[model samples]
Target: MVLQLHVWGPAFALPSIDAQCLSAIAYCSIALPKDAWELIASSDPSVSPTGELPALQNGSTWVSRFRNIVDYLRQYSDGAWDLDRQLDESDRADNTAFASFVESRGQSLIDLSLYVTSHNYYNNTSPAYGNLLQWPNQWILPPKLHGAAKARTDHLGLSSLDLQAIEEHRQRDHSAAVAAGKIPKNLIQRPRETVSGLLGRGSSKNQFRMEALTADFFEPLEAMLGQKAYLLTLKEEDVPSSLDCIALGSLSLALVPELAFPWLRDAMRAKAPLLSAYTERLRRRCFGDSPVEVAHAYSPQSAPASPLPWRAPGRISIAAVGSTLLAELADSTPFLSEIRRNNRLKQAAADSDLTSVEKGAVSMFADSSKKDMYVSIAAAVGGVAALVGYMFHVGLISVASQEQEFEEEEEEGIPDFGNLSAGDILGL
Candidate 1:
């Protein structure tokens, strides 16, 4: 029986990616019994209990959440999903940790994408403070900032003071978004406008940062996948499964365009086909094709056929697949800390109380923001202490030990030789 997969969401947002990924998996000819795929534009409650997009309906069951859907589809395929390559307990934990990491970082990507689309804010321009002007019809401000003071700033103009006020307003707005479950709580918040403006400026430094981070993410996966056709599994028989494609597709999106990573720039240029496919799909699903045309204006390359197909056979049992499959695809890096720091500085500069000079200084030395100053300083001190201790243990800081010995010599305290037993005094 052809599976009746009802996808509920618009074609141009985060949910769209979910839709596309699922579509690709289905197209790969996975055994989803119901073959018909239905995409509903509106967020129907009957379709989704949470009233969110990308919900799936099969038979009597309605499944929401992207990961849940991925899981559901896998069950219909039985053990073909290969969650974590059938790892033992320890490897499974590692996989879970990695998944959590990916999910958090993925949320940031989603937030940035949503911010870019919703406000027409690009990484190169300032984001529109529309929420401050008028609350989104479906979203309500949190109780903390629902009063008259917030209302005043909501309508504030784009003057210098108003710009500053908008930044401050967004800080609270972000918090509200988190509380309302619009965003993940642990994810860091950066001023969408400022970040977009920086990207717009296209500074060499900013470009370098983008390239470095992108390389850090993708290079490893490329190496892992190697010439083998797949990352985790080697067999062609394993090729068409959703688990295989989703993992690769997600990784390809997260890390690509070696221009973002200078060392791999040449390699990425050579393998442009792999990267372009994901972005083009993203463009098609998010911005209208027009924006994609703008994005690829100078590039002469064409998008490749997606490796995974988008049709399935019967109803997929989502819950049985488990989180292990998703976990193995996550990226683990300390870059998140740096990203968070940059975001915090951006938020600090947007505070109403900060003067223009303060904002400038904070932007220049992003690590020195009031919000992170003490914490950063403490972390630095703790890191130094740890390094010194490591060096001491390794006999590298002999000078310090000598200085300590000298300090002990300068003290008036005498050795308590009388307390030492003969056996202790000996080398026994």
Candidate 2:
């Protein structure tokens, strides 16, 4: 019997890179049974409880959330989808951090696209459908007002909508990106494009936000490429045994296309074939005739002349209690030892001195100085260590808290798994 897989979503309308990556995985020969996959585009809430695109159902199991979907596919695929197959804990952590950054910020790109589409960019001269409006708002606005706004909104089209959406998405995106250690905080306010007079000059602020957001990923990209020749590679034999394929597949879809953006493309040209091939394939698949224009349209400012290499840089901030401890240990070990040695010399000087006044003064000075030094060092070290411990405790608590969140999210995302049955897809 043929394996049956159902992907329910308005995937075309959503146009999310992450969602597209999920589609790619679903369509990959190694991951899905031949010609057995189907995509359902209905908006019925019952079809996907989360009201999100890209929920997957196969046989007796239902999976939602991109990470869980990747995990579930890896189990049966023999780990073909594993991204961290060869990575150690630190490397894996780095990759996870990078992925989280991409996932969180990538939404901005999607939102920009949606905003444009809703504004009626394509057939605006004489719209087939009324002017598309904002998404969450469009879902509720009355039909009459939407029609009246059509001309003005359509004139603004994709570019204007995208510009605004990028600006709006940037605030939340930057906060999340910073929290993930993706970008420096300074870039958060940089300016780029100007809004037309009617839109007001303040619109230029939005452009700056996009530039700032894109800057964060540059270092991570350089780091990944600098470490290995292939952007990410998995042995053909291990395709089914790891989730590396899924992660690579996702990253390839997400970052590769952005290369066409002049700033990003120029930066990636050092590894031309890898970036070119990845972008070309996606352009052909998604944008077809207008690949070059689409690529350039999304381009940021020209790439930097010498981008920073990806090894961790800058002073370690004690953002979390755990990091504080690590920072303290890293910063104080040598200095603390030096202080101890210096104290020993001072004590010897006190013992050998002939003048009682001098000896007493030295003793008093040494006593006060040593006490101060010890207290200062101890406080610094102890504070950091305690912070580090507290950070870890908090992280664990957060993870536990998320367990229920994930379940609740899942419950709202996919239909009940209990309703599914074995042999509904592949018998195995």
The candidate maximizing lDDT is: 2
Q: Give the TM-score of candidate 2.
A: 0.38
Give model 1 RMSD, 1 decimal.
Answer: 24.3
Residue-pair clash count for candidate 1: 28
TM-score, candidate 1, is 0.38
Residue-level lDDT tens digits of model 1 in 160-258: 212344577788988889899999988877745544464456556654654554454445444544645433445634433233444433433333321
Q: Can you write out model 2's per-residue Cα lDDT over 1-428, one digit (the tens) per residue? A: 23222232112212223343343343333445434443332222223433233555676555555565556666856865444466667666765665666554443333332223233223221131122222322333223223433333443233454344556776788899989989987774757443343235545664454445444544455455443433344332322212233334333433443221223234334433454454344333332332221112122132121110111112223343343345345435766655655565565454342488777777677678767787888999999999889988779768878998999998898766686687664565
lDDT of 2: 0.42
Question: How much is 201 displaced in model 1, in angstroms?
Answer: 7.1
Using Cα atoms with residue i matched to residue i, what is each candidate's TM-score against the true structure? 0.38, 0.38
